[model samples]
Target: MPRRPSGINDLDLAIYGHIAEGGELTLSEISRLSGRSKGVIFRHLRKLSALGVIEVREVGGVLLASPSRSPRRVIAMGIMRAAEYPYVLGILRGLRDIYGPVRVLVYEDAWREAQDLLSGRIQLAMVPALTALVANRLGGGRVQIIGGGSGGGMGVVRGTGGSGHAVVRTSNTELCAERLGLDGPRSYFGGPGDILGALVSGKVHEGVLWEPYLSMASASGLRVEQCEIEHCCLLSANSGVADQYGKISRIAAAAISSARSADLQAYAKLVDLPVQLVESSVRGYSFHEAPDVAYLERMLDAARRALLPGSSVRDAVVA
Candidate 1:
């Protein structure tokens, strides 16, 4: 036998039926169609929104609900790379339930490419917080901060002799260098693949990096030295598009919340991937629910401090 729908009342059914034709209709149209007061119809619409049955899109002071969910895209670096892609996949999976479909655009540490992508050249972007600062400085107001993760805790790897050999670091390690009061080395590598290759080949005695890479380096018999620094992830979008940013942030936040709500077994399964990495990369990501003006200002403050001449510590909110 076929099962019936659950938790849907008559009013809900009527509203769905009215919008089932897949075209937007105003409150007046709905009221006229159902012979109900405009106030009553609006009340029902609010209920539907609260239940996640519909999305409210505001257009030039008018609110409309499209039959389809809003579109979302993420510009991420190393998105297809083995170490970080899996975690990103998990996060996207959770976001799907809350925000429908999502698309990810990949970049391999080309900040210039990211800038081009963000300047109405592409739909979305996911660059490092440092890169985002550069973008903001260049008047990349079209991009806004939405959500982000704790990429992974970063540290400096040193040789067993405790003497400075060739020093290496991640693309984002500039923050670590500032925190440790060390000017970064003249030469540095970006992607994890490059960094790992340099470490394995003994080209660099010490390096700053995120998890899986760190764990892999340790397992390869390299003496791993921990540096005192906190790494953070950030999401950004075009400044004028606050509504779109809100939608994306909400979806990202919901994904993090869902991941956190998963059982320990599920988290362990996620963490026990083929690669060696930090648990924080998978489970430590978080989001801010009530993000507004003040939150953005704080993020900007932390980002500015991190990019200061010789500062290492940086602050980040998950969403």
Candidate 2:
């Protein structure tokens, strides 16, 4: 299943890029450039036009799209829906309440989110702490950890001690395997959905997963155990938009607290999971409005010990 789409997506951006390259682009030109059908180009242009990021006009009976301002997409990717719930509430609802409608993209993993974020295609992204660090290094002082990340919520479900066939592995998930000395070969999973799929497909019996995925694993008759590594995910922003970090973090935190008390059906739908799973998954984790200085330092130390590639601490984090 795909994540919910509330704004511009990669395909839309590709179409927009064709227009931004200068001169008005006809539907056929954009479709050919983007490898999408004319109807698909038309559909995406509507939203871009409505958002004032592009202007669609009929010129001499041929419809054309012209670029205005480049679109900005705030992405929230997590191991499960619960992890992104606050950002969805805060950025989607709170941003509208304060600023206006903004594009928000949900993801289940950090791979593409990290790529888009570092390439400036993304305005902001909430991803694993390790990913943010590596991205900051890759972007060369162009990216920074803005705020609003999570701690804890990492564990193993039916994890075998160093000798099993395989266990689910992700950036944050592997922390537990490393901490608990699980030395077995790892089967990498993209996100919560992938982990679930692996379980259902019998590809792996154990998974090192986070919150909601762990809960789902438990519900599937697997035993769960908490890992002591407290580093999970963090919020990273393009340095060009550094000024908005404070406001984004504040709104996200408030929205997180607010959503905790509200009905979780919306979040469930966004993550495409049952409301019960969403509710239970969040119970075991802690969400922060700002960076946790002490834990972050500790995680950085661990990263250094693990010989991970990262920028200096000062450049990576806002703290």
Candidate 3:
């Protein structure tokens, strides 16, 4: 039997079912459905939302209810207009949850994150593992992977079940594709989005992508095969913030690891992706601490084999 969510009583479940079936309900609709007074229904609705059994939002001065992941209190994350990291909101929430009113600057590009980290303009950033490793080397040991962000949110794509003349383009997903035996006539693109665009438009038979682009690709009829790489994204802190890196990194790692479907809703408008797409993309991310020793070694090995510009991945990690 499926385990019931805790703190939920029989009454809450019945109320939840009405919202679940109808998609959403206002206080009066739920009241009518349950044959209860509007005042009583409103009270129960508050209880259900507090228990995390349902989501409540306001639209045009009307309260609407729907099914939800057990979301914590929704907080407005003032993500910068240029921010592009899908998980940046979670990082801010993590820091705010721990330090309270901490500062988190966001950027649209990981390379910019690397540049700021090297310049000491920013103390920390969430970047791809290989990017973090290379950036650490580029900064002359000034940067370090203080914590892990997430993994397995990348993949190679090919149409018609990987048959026919495969014109495969690449992105950072190449970091592990070689080790995974993923090889083909390869070209390179600027990033996952460009690669996905080419693939979907039939300009390339294969390409690489990370979510929610990967999700978009699947929805667009492209086949996405996840690469078994555990060193996708990571958290890097520069030497300037080394003193408190441990504390901040732990909180970030925990919060980012626990990032769920509701985080998409809370951050949907900020990210400018469809709430449904972002929420569905959650399954592609497996948030956690740094990659294991072997997986880290594999990514480094692949990075080296690809002739990527960087210092030694081994030296950059600093054990």
Candidate 4:
């Protein structure tokens, strides 16, 4: 008589689940818990091994299985702005699924921290496009541009009329203001959403804001103003870790693609986030793969020329 083959359903996920949890169990132990024959457990174990789901090790003639690799670590910033957080969160979640056990670091003032991380102090970084540009220049090939958000325009909002009303903007807003040739009393907000909220609350006469936030402000019945300014987001890596750049870039791109494919109605199903928030986040926002070296060079040249004397720390690495 020939021995019977195990069915697909008999693969015994519990056995593999145990191995995934950092425990090593022998066939006899699995058999006792699952109420299956030792032969059955042994056959299932072999099948799992063949499928590359677990690794079997022999210790004193006893068989043990363990998971293959440790989880990956990822850090994300630029969350202070509501518009920016969703995409970064989506990328983090997608990476968690692909690499397992991903960690995220959120920062309101990402410009400074992003530079620090790219210098090898931290492993991963997500920052505004402007900050990425600056980092690329100062870090001298130490920073790799893995991915970035689709380009969008920023807007300037101002209260209709008020004395002592503040005018809030980004630290980098001067670049945009200079382009627009705006001269007025201004205050800097840490992030775009903060500026928008201040304008909506009548605390600021004007603010610089991004797309959906601009739309949301108008919908709120507040007197809103709009001006177009360039905006983008970036995912970068330390230079020594350039080998991982392609992998990280692909993962970031997939996250954006996946989120775009998600059902609008199911947006509410995302963990710990509201539907309106998700919708606002996905709307009008886009993702782009790694930037071309030539374009980056152009931006670097422009920054060096545009920034005031001693304002820019260094020049970006070209090539």
Most accurate candidate by TM-score: 2
Judge candidate 3 at residue 2 and give its lDDT: 21
**TM-score, cand. 1 vs. native:** 0.53
lDDT digits (tens) for residues 1-319 of candidate 3: 0223344454554576587568778977988888888787777788867656578898998889986665432221122221124556656645544323233444434566677777876666666677677777878989788876666766767754332222112224556455555445455565556666676666666765667777777888777788765666677777876776777677666666556633566566655667787667757767675546576775566777543423236535886
Off by over 4 Å in 3: 1-90, 94-109, 159-171, 180-185, 308-319
Model 3, TM vs. native: 0.60
User: Please, what is the whole-model Cα lDDT of each candidate in the order they appear?
Assistant: 0.50, 0.62, 0.61, 0.54
Q: Is candidate 2 or candidate 3 better by lDDT?
A: 2
| Selected candidate, larger lDDT, 1 vs 4 | 4
lDDT for model 1 comes to 0.50
RMSD of 1: 14.0
Question: Ten residues in a row with the worst lDDT in model 3?
Answer: 74-83
Give the higher-lDDT candidate: 1 or 2: 2
Candidate 2: regions farther than 4 A off: 1-51, 59-84, 96-100, 159-170, 199-202, 229-231, 304-319
Which residue pairs show backbone clashes in model 2? Answer: 162-183
Per-residue lDDT of 1-319 in model 4, one digit per residue for the tens?
A: 0111234332345565455544667767777777879787888778766655566778998877665444123223233343443445566554444433333444545565565666565556665555666676777767656776555435555555432323222223444444444434445566556766677666666665555566666676655544432345567677765665676677777765565565544334423345676576556565554555565555554444434423233333344
lDDT of 2 at 166: 36
Q: Report, for all candidates in order, the number of backbone clashes.
A: 15, 1, 0, 5
By lDDT: ranked, best first:
2, 3, 4, 1
**What is the model-wide C-alpha lDDT for candidate 3?**
0.61
Tell me each candidate's TM-score: 0.53, 0.70, 0.60, 0.58
How high is the lDDT of residue 306 in model 1? 43
Residues forming the 10-long window of minimal summed lDDT in candidate 1? 73-82
